[model samples]
Target: MKFFCATFAMVVTSATQAEVFTYECDTPPLSVWEVAGEWCSPLESLKNGLLIHQVDLCPGWPPPGGQFVFYTRSLADFDGAATFFVQWELQTNGDSSEFVGVCPASLSLGSFGPVFYQIVIARDTAKFHRDDGLPNIYISIAPDVPHTYRLELFGADLYTWYIDGMVVASGVPEGAYPSFYPAMNFGTRAWRLPNTTRWNYIRYGTIPLDAAGDYDSDGSVDEFDLSFFVECLLGEGVPSGPGCGFADFDADGDTDCDDWVAFQAHWTGPPAVPPIPPPCAVVGDTNCDGAVNVLDINAFVMALSDPSAYAIQFPNCPMSTADANGDGAIDILDINAFVALLQ
Candidate 1:
């Protein structure tokens, strides 16, 4: 079944001081998601302004994959942590009959009956299931915090999971299942007291996983990326396509100077060993001399006069560095701006 592209909503959380984009599901309603048992509360709003699904008694039906995210945290200090899952359902006589939960934390594949693939995440650990040949692999994380969980199904069979911003696990399911869904159940081994699983929101769409401002997917955000970003910004190169989403460094759904500020933070190096650079650094400092001066002014003039000639003369300098006004365009106005900076 074809899934509709995602629509995003910008959200600000005062407590965490973080900006988030929530993808709202836009698919035609199949049915109000099935509740597993009586103890489970159908999706509803609570006094705390969070949408919750009380998984105290039953396992709810899992929803299918599209690009989306769900912010979840356990509401009660139960004996065991609450569990959320996605499963593959096998077709029987042209209709789904058996369910195999992927990402199973406490359950073994096919132990409960169906031959299946699954990935299970619990409070402290994550588990993966593909087939009988490979042993289930587990990755551990600190539990019970309001961390962002993201899942993306791409290529032929590749599925990847991300917690916060790091990829924790990814693999292709061994046997092909016609469809997938998300499920929620309280506890790993047994049902616990009346507890809640709070959801800030469930976004449906491909999350932008590329390194912010690293438009070329290279290891670092540097001069080359800056050039590409400026090209897109000025509409001079490839029309700002979906691929340009990587430049949205602030995650505010737009590529602008604000994002440029965040992108500059990574200019020192790759994410692993990022050394913070000073603030108020000028974008037009093309000479690499730690200051914007007359030398940069000359460089900008040469580049503006004849880009091809300038490229051959100073092959090391990126033409984008001369955009002193941050307007994503290089022209005489930038020359004037640079002179003003020198003044």
Candidate 2:
């Protein structure tokens, strides 16, 4: 069937953190999922994942046999300028053609635009099925094994797919339209056949990069990142420019004070590796050597002046305890309270 839909280019915004939505199929949360059609039984949560069984009895029924889709609740709608990513981990028991779809919020049962992007998986091969008259690119993958499928919707009408961490395909679709929300659907495609699929998990977000605060794709977050981070620091809700996503540490949609704190925590000078943050044991032990004394004096000063430097110097210790004044902020106001602890 010809379905109507569109694609969006990633937009620059410092409004809200990209929402990270994840579902583990082992215990599917029915409250957050919606089901459509008959003959397809509700998915059962198993130790392996969520199981979908396709029976052979309903071979020619219209809604029942044609396609049985399970989808998530609604999300905010956006136009062609929005950006997002989705990943699914799954495996099939036998030969099967499964469909995965995403649609806007106002999708209608009869509207062709309901499914913005559709993927068709037949056993060891998969392809993008859109109504835009473009030829589909089929990617061959390892069959019967669990596969990690990722879809990235970036730039205008542009998309890239990764299977098992390898880039398999990239393309742009024509005649795109706006989307209502970021909702997803999964089900059987075409005639129902006897087969089963276990969905291990599904995750999607705005910027789900491997390393947070590392805009340059480098291994560490350093001064090189700070320069770019400054440019992206448009306060909450205001639009940022391209590549600003890296500085959005708190994912609160902006590169403000909150993100700066998180950035300071991750800062590693030059190309050095950042140390794993040490636990905070005592409320005033900024040095993290299991003591609260003069040895912590210099560490406390650095924590208040240049938090990023403090992080690099005391990589194994937490700086949060620098708030000795208990005012919840590490500033000069806490000096008096901090001295009392030292004495």
Candidate 3:
């Protein structure tokens, strides 16, 4: 189904860092990548030790994901008026049929005149026509200087572009497309001298909100989030609670069985809840008062014998931390483990 970004805004923040994979090509590694078109030369290094692609025809390379961050650069000027293009593409089956969820959204940058540089976002429909509402921005930078570019896809819909650390444009395109792979191409409308484009690096990975089992947004996936997820599934609270959208692990807009299955795989722990108590704390200390006395034992017995009854008696505890053995199931095993902890 076609989905579009509901909001568009320029945001700048100095918060959180993403783990990225970096590729620096001091030498040509054409064999590791799929390079297409006859005019494309194998990757070569410039005098400055940066890797570049010098081509007289349209040359393309592809990179994959549904949501990710991509950073690349052009190390030199185009020999003629050729355009450098990067597109998010869907892979096709062996029969040349389009893969599911692939859309043809692309960013094009080039010099229209000696002093003018232009950038445009294009979304191609299934019928191979450009959507009329795409946005374009223009700016001027010195020739032969490296320029940085960044593209971010948030969730499954929002697209944001950046130039030199500043947001240049952002919007949602109309139409359905599968997860995308970055396809980088350099070509001109008319033949000209071979233009060389340097690629400094490309970094791509999952967006945090797109991470599985991170329902609580505490920057980590753990039992607290899982307990909250259970609450969400049971309809015990409002669905719009903070970070509740992370519970929709499948990004399908609803918390259901499918999300549960996805969450299980994404969970980083042993599927146990509340997290282990700290040293000097009792294993079954539901109230966290740091004692192993009668009250703690009573709460454990109640939870083990009758969960519903225990929940009614201690509504705030949730019994997640009560499982002393860290087993996923809460049963006699946990009861014994808790008792052994007291000794």
Q: TM-score of predicted model 2? A: 0.50
Give TM-scores for every candidate, taking all chains together and pairing residue i with residue i: 0.35, 0.50, 0.32
**Relative to the true structure, how large is the alpha-carbon lDDT of every model?**
0.42, 0.55, 0.40
Estimate the overall C-alpha local distance difference test score of candidate 2.
Answer: 0.55
lDDT of 2 by residue, 224-334 (tens): 455446646666666543335677776665667567667767777664533223221366788876678999899999999999999888775667779887777889998
Local accuracy of candidate 1 as per-residue lDDT tens digits, 1-343: 1121233333332321222233223321112222222323333333333334333224553333111112222211111111112221110110011112221122222222222444454555555555668786666666565545544444336655665545777776453222232222321111322223443434332223554665434445655455445533422232343334666665555455565556666674433322212122346676535577778766677777878877666554566667777787878878777777777
Q: lDDT tens string, model 3, 28-147? A: 435223333332332344333344443233344232212211223331221221111222212111111111212111223222221211232111111121233543343443344454
Flag the better candidate by TM-score, 1 or 2.
2
Number of the predicted model whose lDDT against the real structure is largest: 2
Residue 332, candidate 3: Cα error in Å is 70
Candidate 1 CA-lDDT value: 0.42
- Predicted structure with the largest TM-score when compared to the true one: 2
Backbone Cα, N, C clashes tallied per candidate: 18, 15, 5
